[model samples]
Target chain A: MDKNKSINQSANKNESQSENQSRYIGVNEWKRHGFQALWALVTNSYLLGFIQGKIYKGRLKNLCVPGLNCYSCPGAVGACPIGAIQAVVGSWNFKIAFYAAGFLVFIGALMGRFVCGFLCPFGLIQDLLHKIPFPKKLQTFRGDKALRKLKYMILAVFVILLPMFVVDILGQGAPYFCKFICPAGTLEGGLPLVLLNKSMRGAIGWLYAWKNAVLLATIFLSILIYRPFCKYICPLGAVYSVFNPISVFRYRVDKESCVDCGVCAKVCKMQVNPVEHANHPECIRCGACKKACPVNAIR
Target chain B: MSRVFRSRRIGILLMAAGLILMGFGIHRGEMAVVFGKAVNICMECIGIG
Candidate 1:
């Protein structure tokens, strides 16, 4: 009877302890911060979304927050790194995105998926949308080992190279990704701009139609799949991922405690073969696996 | 026989259907209606709508 009492007491104690830990994986309440405001700037271009409260105070800076924000967002007090790079290219300016690059490096070194999990507006948008009642899945490397490298190609050629090298007849550089390829730009800036301004409608051509098609496809995919942009495309995610291995807030796997049952792998949205490399660059570090582990092996 | 292949085949067909719908709707849907109204109203305006 004494032994039975002791066991029950210990179980209750553990239950109580788990209850007290409010900051555990999914229970944490989101508090508004720099990420939201910055996200608004990156994702929306409305007049209300514009006029950032901080812009008047001279807090404008680049790449500082290490998320994809729209430079053209009305409330933007500071310039977006990608937009800055494009604008710099357009203007034939040398070293235009230096500040943005510096900011990305600094934040990335401090915490890797800390940005992906917390700071990125797009990531937040996907997570919330995913909560809707639907059968969801997480896919892994199937065929085409070469296919995964498409994002890197986007980064090298589409995101960086063409904008820097290819010049318009006016000898000006333009944000090619934003104008031609970026679904984020289309969703955030292009749609809003065209919607509000009647005159901008006539400017609609093949380019505008192309941007709309990409935006529509992304939205459709996001409803079914988990973060199609972040998974297959996002050049910004690719950049920040490089520093994941060394980042301060990293996912550490205690292999000895791990049962290798693939429970963690099954839950991961990024499809990181956690058993191989826990802190894989693809890990947005949503901590679903950490919570899912029966033995609490994944940290 | 191949799961991914089947999905892709269906997906491509869906995409083609979607394009046809969008093309037709571009000339007739709500978006088209809005665009048509805005365009017809202003004969010379050549910008955003």
Candidate 2:
């Protein structure tokens, strides 16, 4: 009788602990979502620009917003870092984009992909899309690891090399990523402008059609997968991931407390093993691992 | 040095380097270049071409 009572008591204790942990995780998730929505609004806060169907033309536009926001977005108060870098590199003058590069380095060193987790408007969009009830959510698939490396290639070829090499008759190059790929540009800039101004609607052509297709695909894929763009396509995420290991705001696992339960790995949507690789490049620092740690091993 | 300390030191150094590079870019009028491009509604850049 004593043995049975003790076993039931232990089981009850475990159940209560699990319930508390889930409640804590829920609170953290809500807090993160709130912060993300607030940051998106703050960055894209030029309400007048949206109403007028005009881009912000202030000196603040000189500064980059450390995310993949489109500067051409009607409500954007600041420039996109990737677009700013391409402009400098693709310019006929062919000078280094020191300000843009410096801004990236500083932000990366400070927070790494925390910007992806909490600040990016596009990241927030993907997060919200992924929340829509779906029949199947794929955490990983075939070629996932291999596909993750493609963003680095995109960064090199489209953002850097193509702009530096491929020039027009006037020795000017184009922002190829924004021109051909960036769904954020199409969704945030192209769609709104076209809807608001009849002149912009007339200007839409094959290229606009292609951009719209890409945006639609991104939206569709985001419903099934978590941060498909950040995982496989964002050049800015590539830049920030490089700094994840050494960034000031990085993850640290407490060796003494960790019990090798593998809970963190199972909880991590980014597929990072927090116990083994707390500061993995793919970690957006989403705190899922930390929240799911039964022993509070991750910090 | 301990790992944490070393990481912190490297971050601080990188931050300083970034600030210096930004100041140099400002000195060389790159801010104006970014501002000029940003303020304009480049329809081609957004794929309305």
Candidate 3:
């Protein structure tokens, strides 16, 4: 009788412990989502632009937001960092994008990829898409490590190199990443403006079709995987990731408290082993590992 | 220096550098350049033109 009573108590304790852990994770997720939504709304607050089908042309547009928000987004009051960089680099007069580069350095030093985790509108979209209750969600796959490096290449070739070297007759270069890639631009800027403006509808051609295809692929892939764009394609994410290790706000694993249970690794959507790589460039600092750590080791 | 203090120092230095760079850019009228690009609808960004 005593044995059975003890067994029941132990079972109850285990259940309560799991409930507590899940509650902690839930709170963190809510906080992150709230912050992301607030930032998105704050940055893209020009509601009249959406209704009137015009881009915001306020003085605030000179400032670059930390995430991959499109400057051409109908409601965006601030410019995108990547877009701003490409613009200055591609200009006939400027070889260096000092303003945009400064903004990136400031944000990266302050929070690293924490912007990706808790500020980016597109990141919030991916998080929502990933929560659609799909079966067989893939956390990692073949060539995942190799594929992760693709974002850096895109940053180098499309955002920086092509925009710097490739020029038109007037000696001005094109925003290659914005023109050829960037699903955010398509979803936020292209579709809305085209839908609202009949003239823009007539202007739609092969390029718009190509961008739509890319956007479709991103949307579907986001449903299957966690942040496929951030992990594989986003140049902004690539830039911020470089600062993750030394950023002011970063993860630190407490050696004395960690027990090697591997729970944090299992819960991490980014596939980062926080115990081994506390501030891994891949880690978005989403707080999943910290919340999942049984001994409260990660901070 | 300890790891935390070292990380904080680096972050502060980077922040200062970024501020200085931004100030220089502003002095050079790069803000106006950025404004010129951002105020207009970027056809390239929308994958048009």
Query: Chain B, TM-score, each prediction?
Result: 0.46, 0.80, 0.83
Stretches off by above 4 angstroms in model 1 are A1-64, A131-141, B1-49
**Is model 2 an incorrect, acceptable, medium or high docking prediction?**
medium
lDDT (10s digit) by residue, model 3, range A17-109: 666546544424877898899999999999899999999988899898988899889999999989998988998888788888888988998
What would the per-residue lDDT of candidate 1 be over residues B1-49, giving only the tens digit for each residue?
Answer: 4864553453344334434543443333223222222212111111112
Worst ten in a row by lDDT for model 1 chain A:
A50-59
lDDT of 1 by residue, A1-299 (tens): 99999999888876654543333334332443345545655533334633321111122432123566544433433444455444544444342343344445555655665677766766666666655556754454464235556767787776677767787686655456666667755654565556655666667787777778887787777777677777777777777788677665577788899866566676666777677898787887766777766678887
- Would you list the clashing residue pairs of candidate 3? none
The superposed Cα distance between candidate 2 and the true structure at residue A27, in angstroms, equals 7.6
Looking at model 3 chain A, which ten-residue stretch has the lowest summed lDDT? A19-28
* Model 2, runs deviating above 4 Å: A1-28, B1-4
Query: Proportion of native contacts in model 3?
Result: 0.72
i-RMS for every candidate: 20.1, 1.0, 0.8
Pairs of residues clashing in candidate 2:
none
How many Å off is the CA of A156 in candidate 2? 0.3
lDDT of 2 by residue, B1-49 (tens): 5977876887777878888888888788888878988999877667786
